[model samples]
Target: MSDCYELFLTCPKSLEGLLVEEATQLGLQEVREQVAVVRGQGDLETAYRLCLWSRLANRVLLVLARFPVQNAEDLYQGVLAVDWHDHLMSSGSLAVEFSGHGSGIDNTHFGALKVKDAVVDKLRTADGVRPSIDKVNPDLRIHLRLEKGEAILSLDLAGHSLHQRGYRLQQGAAPLKENLAAAILIRAGWPRIAAEGGALADPMCGVGTFLVEAAMMAADMAPNLKRERWGFSNWLGHVPALWKKLHEEARARADAGLAKPPLWIRGYEGDPRLIQPGRNNIERAGLGDWVKIYQGELATFEPRPDQNQKGLVVSNPPYGERLGDEASLLYLYQNLGERLRQACLGWEAAVFTGAPELGKRMGIRSHKQYAFWNGALACKLLLLKVLPEQFVTGERRAAGDESRSAPQNEPARLSEGGQMFANRLQKNLKQLGKWARKEGIQCYRLYDADMPEYALAIDLYGDRVHVQEYAPPRSIDPEKAQARLLDALAAIPQALDVDPANVVVKRRERQSGTRQYERQGSEGRFLEVVEGGVKLLVNLTDYLDTGLFLDHRPMRMRIQREAAGKRFLNLFCYTATASVHAAKGGARSTTSVDLSKTYLDWARRNLSLNGFSDKHKLQQGDVMAWLAEDRGEYDMIFIDPPTFSNSKRMEGVFDVQRDQVQLLDLAMARLAPGGVLYFSNNFRKFELDEGLAARYAVTEISAETIDPDFARNTKIHRAWRLATR
Candidate 1:
């Protein structure tokens, strides 16, 4: 056997450079870096040490053979050329993993099959006795990489990925892999901070990955000290004495490190469910004395370490995967920045996030950024020095003014145009506030593009503000439009006397199909607002439209006024706001139908919120299909459909202009005698079918449905009342 063997250390992308440095420091010779891998030459003891010590590597492979191959036969021949008996016994089991493609092997499964056949055939005896395939715990795990028509075969020294540190059996929805977490800590300078006897904290720690990893590093403990098995454990070349020596040395070092006073490492998770699991993980890692976890919210997260000790604050906050999540996440990052400024002065901070744009919203300048891949998603690690100088308090007016160092949560100073916009908002609020207060309305439209340059519709739900910026015209410069939007956003909180963190912003564009009903966020946060004596749920952060339609307030009120002792039917009910109003107004029963199960579930919540679930029915199906099968008659009905929809659940596309007659006729069939059916749509160019007037008594009620709040935009929605002729 060769005294030295070529080794390939595989890691996550962008860690190859760090792995090369680490491998060299671990006594590897001729170390070189490659994409997602580092290559070096090491002896048996060196290989074993690397496996036990590497913090960034995912796998440690010992190259067995390298040969040129051009076809499947060539691949088989190349793998068979290696002496299998020296590595595996005839009674042992083996597994083969093949990566890359070409050499006439397009499918990875087929490539793996060929490699397995070669090993089995070579190990077969005259009596056909050979090794069996055992994927889970193989005596020999072979890896073949076919690249550029050359095949490189190796033995996987680590049975599974090294990232499975064995301490984290339970994790949160999205947990960072231990190796990735280690790399982040290294980049954040956690090692140096720990070496200096500094403390560490993770405010938004999910399952305590960062806390455990930091504790292990600080205590000079080998990450894989607790692992029981490896790919080479059962191999014939395995040296038990050498491995035992390394293990004992590692244990002694860990024991000695633990003998000293442990560094303070704490984690705070907002979810109560994760608290016990995090404590279990820390205990399993034998870091109980060094690390502690508590259930705490981000708003109240304050880490107290020993006096006169400064450290690193590291966290991997959720970046969100849904569409509208960015808007809500903006506030989370803002809060994190605020907390850092308030509590962690003179400390360093590392924030890992998939949304770099949202990270920029933290209002703290990141001195450096490192790019990483969390699985397939590209992410950034923003490193910040939480000093007063890094706080972004807008532009400095003159030097060293006390006002210039204002906190990030403070309302930003307005520009000339912003002041003008703020003045307009004040004027509109003064006029609308009185009317809304007198009408007992807690939610109303405060501004609807009052200034064309701003092009935003600001709605007030209780004390929270929902701002929708109309997509700028193609002729408008995007940069200028963005500046104008900033101006308007800055003006909103100041003018409305609300906190800056209470504002949520989203861009509004012409939606097609069922896009409007699609979930934009997953926060599931709902605000209760009262309108027309009904308590309704409004999720300003999770959808393009809040649950309660501000423009439809008058229509809902009209429905309530006429709903006494009548059966009510609401189609395209959204979150069933209208149905709630009807039920509140003493409707005998209410049935609401929509295509979204999410919305129906939300409707159920809204109905339950108002203590009206018993007589209320929430149906989840295509409204057209539901209406066709529904045989019960309704005394009063209201339908407000989208401008256009191509939902997959529906049979075909629905165009308000083309399908209006058919929709109205189908709905009219369910309308009982003397019943009134109110139909409305927001299609700007919609003209009522003239034939409906002849078929039934149809009266245009568009004028009466427009409330004083939506008076500026009279065409918000056109309404009609129809009955049997």
Candidate 2:
């Protein structure tokens, strides 16, 4: 026997040359090479040799069954004919793994399921006992492939995906699997270079996979020598004698090939998440005693030991995929490139990136660019060798595919959503008087209110902020909610009297049920008003309410003192503070109106808490529509409508900023000549349409209206005192 055995070696695309070297190094003759795969004849001894030696190959597969099968029926028949019971015990468990083909099969998962069913069905019929199926791990892992319409069934020799490499106890977002890491090292010619005293590294060493892979290759250990078993071990015709000899020989060879000082390998990770996993992987690869893990920003990094020099530096930087901003990721790569020039000299650096912009950032031309697929992500592995002269100067000169970094003095542009939120929140903070502070108040304002997503907060006092989250309103422009939030923040200061910086606005991340994130804009607040020997410091600004509603700010304060020994009326009293003030000031009676049953109940509670009657009239009806049909008289009236109001009960659109004149005119017609009307609006640019001021005593009281907490701006509310002529 010439020791002829079937051999199949898999390589990541673009690394064919490296795989060829690995195969030849294993003493396996390559009778055939097909694109990403190399197939040849080898004995059981040669198979073990390749398993112990090859670093570039994903896995060395041993073909168990090759059939020109087409449909599901053919698949079932071919699987049934295999002498499965010869190697597998009746008590053994099996897992079916599959890949390749779309037109011939609906999907890989479905194809794999069909293959599993066929294998188990065959065993049950022929041997009278079928093995159990294990998805996680199993005694035998069967691999079925339908490629280019040809179905080939092979035993997965590496139990866990070859990527397991027995390393990495942790990981980062979208980490590179271990086998792929080793493949890149071999593909980059690291083994050949390492054998000659060259070095290797990964600057963006996510979980240290590439560095660990390089270390393992440098150690001269078979990638799978640590692995326990393969799918073929349980196959019908498996040669126990040959496999045992091959396994032992591989161990002996690996033991003999150990280097004295170990190849110079380094793995650098800027993210903390990758460090632990990287450490675990290095230890698992039996290289933990050799490799070092570091956590720091790539740009400000200094080499741990200045002595190690002139090897390979590989980095997989940001790719602008499912991450923060695209500009942030780009800046990260740009700074990374600068580091390569400033710190890494007389050395070769390989950058594996999904973003090609990385090569441009390095400011150095790549000698070789290898294209590889990092999980359906088309990526390029760029290689740059720093020559001796270039290394000494340690300065970058821009050339093809490279450029200068962004100038520090240049203006920064924010996303529209971010800008709107920041701008509006700042403006509102400037005018507010009351602040939600942790020491005095507890809930301090968090976000100023800008973001496409909805989140509004009123800091109650520290640790507790009343939070309100609203969705985008239909029938309005998409930016309406955002615009309203800005408007709300701007007007809040006049209503409360707080510094602009004190109010913070943050957008809430939408999530299901209890997992959602909410605002803590204002958690602690100490500002409290005293009336009738009672103290009031609870923050109404931390939630959706921005403390004092500027529209009602003047009205609340007016009613606070004026309602003493007088009748008071509050229409659409959301927080019912005005009605409470009336009762606190010793008013004879009070009435409140709102469509919300929840708020109406709240208004009744407000009156009762202030020693006023719960018997005070509370109407759950549209204010505009209800007042149109009925008449009620009061000694003093405070009517302030929102700039834009739409209710579930009315078809009319109420625009207080624009419709204040007509709205006030109606109130005046119902008012007694001496009965005063306090009218207000929150529209900052509000200008009273001419004739109204002439008809009534309309004095602009905006300047006189403000509280200490809302000191951000005085113009947050527009107020007027009107008495009929």
Most accurate candidate by TM-score: 1
Residue 682: error of model 2 in Å?
15
Q: Rate the local accuracy (lDDT) of all candidates.
A: 0.87, 0.62
Model 1, global lDDT:
0.87
Error of 2 at 423 (Å): 22
Q: lDDT tens string, model 1, 152-251?
A: 8999999999999899999999999999999999999999999999999999998899999999999999999999989889988999999999999999
> For every model in order, what is the number of clashing pairs?
1, 80
Model 1 misplaced stretches (Cα beyond 4 Å): 394-428, 449-457, 464-528, 534-547, 558-639, 642-654, 662-678, 690-704, 720-725
TM per model?
0.85, 0.57
